[model samples]
Target: MSDTTTTSLLDAITVPAAEGRAIPDAATGETMGHAPVHDVEHLNRAVAAARAAQPAWAALGHAERSAILHRTADEIDAHAEELARIIAQEQGKPLNGPGARFEAGGCAAWIRNAADTALDPEVVFEAPGTRSELHYGPLGVVGAIGPWNWPAMIAIWQIAPALRMGNTVVSKPSEYTPLSVLAVAELMNRHLPEGVLTVVSGGRDVGEGIAAHPDIDKVMFTGSTKTGRAIVKSSAGNLARLTLEMGGNDPGIILPGTDVKAIAENLFWGVFINTGQTCAALKRLYVHDSQYEEVVRTLADMAASMPMGPGLDESSVLGPLSTKQQFDIVSSLVEDARSRGARIVTGGEAAPELGPHFYRATVVADIDDGARLVDEEQFGPAIPVIRYTDVDDAVARANASDQGLGASVWGSDVAEAVAVAQRIEAGTVWINQHGTLNPDVPFGGVKGSGYGMEFGREGLKAVSAPKVITV
Candidate 1:
């Protein structure tokens, strides 16, 4: 009944910081909590703790480590609701809907799945007198840098594999949404031995410190391509094994004969999930010229129908963009498209009536590949519907970007959609659906989207060093 949004639990449980900085709420623009601004010195200590713990932790061997991971997953599942609320409060996502609870559930599931996945020693070659075996050796310490969007899930994506692969972890979550991640780290640490997992909350410099830390043998990061590039540059000093999941200007192609009405809701959520803050969310939608208007009309109507508000509100389907800077970016891109003759099919302006950073789910029609909305990764709730005459040309346009994160093909005929999806240059290409990720499926990027994979056996390998032993 109160007009104010619910506060984060971390706001009450403030860990002392030498130089604390405030983090604002996404919905109200009110300062929700303060996190300690950790510097290189703080990072060094965390990394040292990781180093001190790695050998003993790794010495526990696969079974013991797996048990601990299972216990950690249990802890996560037990605290799901509380954790989800923390996520909603700090990260500006609906608590009950596919927001905080979904993300928290995902974190728990990823850990459980990681525990079940095996990284068994392989005997590569064997003769009567000689044998060679390949084993995955734990890298001393893994440095994880998680982004603000889906902080808990992405942190688990980074940490679960690292820990399961027998490495100690030191994580630095984006300062804006650090609380949920800090809480995750606490839960994980409780289930493990001391110094095995550490979280240092800070800004850009702390992330850079983690990347450049000599003690950290590997760095797993999920963020912007610009920040990914910076991490690559810094990690070069240590020659650390790096898995970077970066930017995506993902495309969704709607084939000529597809039923617009049938797929509208799926299309709407595919592009607009996480308020379009998703790295793999469809940013550009290529519709057949014949179906363009119908597709646009249906999607726009759906977008306009959804309620936008604070995460705590039960009626709200979409929450505010996680930060003011992101809101500005979305606004600027929409404005640029408008200036270039793109029609605002539905919502475009910020909903000040809702709260700060609450930009309505926007749909832009009559946009070309040249439009900013079509080309750039807006990373917000604004989608451009581009009309394409030829299917080949559409695929070409989709592959023309500097990014190749994810792509989707939609058609009434699943086989035809599959055929077209194969042509798009991206890490993962979907048929009928978009951005549906599985714990066992490997996902990453190509071209300027950055390299290396996450999830599955490959993800386990990314956090490990393969050593060949001959006897």
Candidate 2:
């Protein structure tokens, strides 16, 4: 639990490999470390090892597993800053703000939630001669495929619940940010029994293998919709129970008469947190005609004032895009919106002086629903503000999207905001806030955003198998 212990833990996993894929620092294009490039065969062995170890883990029962997870949470707290450093270097989220440190803390908080959540057998029915009780048991081994945006936190979201519900886990971290996940798993393995958890740091092949492997009873994935579709296909071979949390183009509606200044900072952070690489970040905004100009101007000023630089910089609130592919996508979408004559309120260019993957925090106004930046999930520090006069039309436009992960409504009237939030077609809706998550709240998506819930007691259920006992 000391600094030296944390350093040794990281060193054990980050030892230079003779032949492994080079991982680059997101802030600078310099090579930071290497991750072992595992293949399908490696995935097979991991799954097999997990399968071999699952029965004994399940035998430990919920109380015992929960106790272990509680200790793991302690370990996470001890190594939080170290984990944050790794996340900052590998994933390009700044140490400050809702970036690396926040993510590292989130991992521990979620684990504690999973451990504390009680899932005792429930008595559903009682008759004159019979009674029915519902119980949740382990599904053996769960394959967790995580994303680059929140490598360590999301991996914990998948792993913690599965472990609490008595299932072993084989996790496949995103290729873009493997070391953070590996480092986290290394700490977790300290408390976990051998083969109970594995981090297979590999590419698409490993992900595909995890989905299709017959031994993996369930697969929990968080990433793009396109990739979610492919996982569905791969999982079909084995009919693996899947929980996919995919892409989201979340919309935020600012009601007329709302105070723009009061909500500006929250709105700005909602859109630009982690440099806006979040799955449920506010991607588009629909402002009532009366407040559109003020909202746009206020957000632009806030975005301009915040520093955007390397993740290691103490003053930086925003960092570069995590990968070149993501950087290109954001650039292309913003360009497409610009070509369509949308007014660039602020930050319309990349910060090449900062880093190769650094795109400036951008806000485009006078844009309609059809603009590529407004329609597609840009997944970067770019937001499009669209003007609308009718509240009904605004609700309709927000609900029209194929993706429905999370949405927010802002207004002075709390009742009115809640009413508007109810109509938004998203898994979770917020009033005067956006993208704020609690470990106790159930989070997931509908439509193309993917199915299955995570967090709270429901999240514990998602990774578990239900059984009915009637007598």
Candidate 3:
């Protein structure tokens, strides 16, 4: 075990102590607060601290480590309400409703589950003179780079498993949504040993530094493909183990016999949750030609009925995009599709009155596969509905993306839906549902969606190294 040292205020200082970045309220575009912007030096210090603390932390018994993690989770639960409000203000997910609380609750659940998860040593061979056992051991310091879509929950997703496996962590939250994650670190750090867990908030430079750091043994990141590629290149400096959950252009296929009304509400939330910022949200909908019009009209009516306003407003069901950049991405895709003769059944423009980044829930039909909205991930509150005549062709089209993160098939016939789900090429395939993730289930992507599982025992192993012992 390495020597333990007490952490001081200096350990938490950002590189440019006086310079901070303002955090904008996603719903109102108003200044909520400012997060200290760190630099490469701050990130390097965090990695060094984590590296120094990891040996001692991993030296503790698994049960002892688990207890500390549970205590951190308890602290998180105690502050759920306060955390939820802060998260809503910063990330634009509804507070009184399901958005903020769901993320907060998820953090607690995943942390607790990770605490309980353990890999027992396995006996490999038993002979008169020889025996072997397989073990999963910690990989020292882990670097966690979090995303903005579900700031608190995703950060916990990375931190919990790494800590549970007896590794110290240095995490960096997205600059756009750093407050909630910083708050998570502040509360969690109170229950954790000094240098066990640290959060360095900064822009691209800090992220690159962590990935390229010599001391960080593993890297877990959730973000875009472009950035994930860069991290892969930087991590080559030390060949750090990586788990990346990148971009996804998920598809939801509505079979001809599916009951449109029965699934409308679930379908609406499935696609539009978190204002459609979810990586695995149903980005494109492929419907049978017979039900194309019905699906589009039903979805448009359901979308229009839901009110859009500030996330803190109890009546609003949807909030603005988290940033002006995201708003522009969604707007541009919708515009490109609209120009290509795709009919916008409902919304297709920005809601500047609500906020600078507000975009209405949109449904576009009469679109071919060539449309940008249909081919690419809008990553916002816009979905394209493509008409298909043959089931085989629909499945083929759905699996055509460079991304294979998640896909779903909807139909009244349970057997048929499950069978169809088997054909969609994605890491996770859903039948009559979409993006339903649990801690016990392993989830990841294939192809350009990025690699490595994030949950279940497989995820726990991702943070660990396997060693074989012989006797």
Per lDDT, the best of the predicted structures is: 2
User: Which pairs of residues collide in model 3?
Assistant: none
Give the deviation of candidate 2 from the true structure as CA RMSD. Answer: 1.6
By TM-score, the best candidate is 2
**All candidates: TM-score:** 0.95, 0.98, 0.95
Candidate 3 overall lDDT versus native: 0.88
Q: Sum up the clashes in candidate 1.
A: 0
Candidate 2 lDDT score relative to the true structure = 0.91
How would you encode candidate 3's per-residue C-alpha lDDT over 1-471 as one tens digit per residue?
111144322123222324777777888878776688778889888888888888899989799999988888997888787778778888998875458878888888999999997678989998999999989999999999999999999999999999999899999999888888987787688688889999898898889888999889999999999999999999998999999999799999999889998888778888999889998899999999998889999999988888888877878878889888998899999999989998999999888898888998999989989889988899999999999999999999998999999999999998999999988889998888888899999999998899999887998999999899999
lDDT of 2 by residue, 221-257 (tens): 9999999999999999898999999979999999999
| Clash pairs (backbone) in predicted model 2 | none
Candidate 2 TM-score, true structure as reference: 0.98
- RMSD to the true structure for each prediction, in A, is 3.6, 1.6, 3.8
Off by over 4 Å in 3: 1-19, 125-129
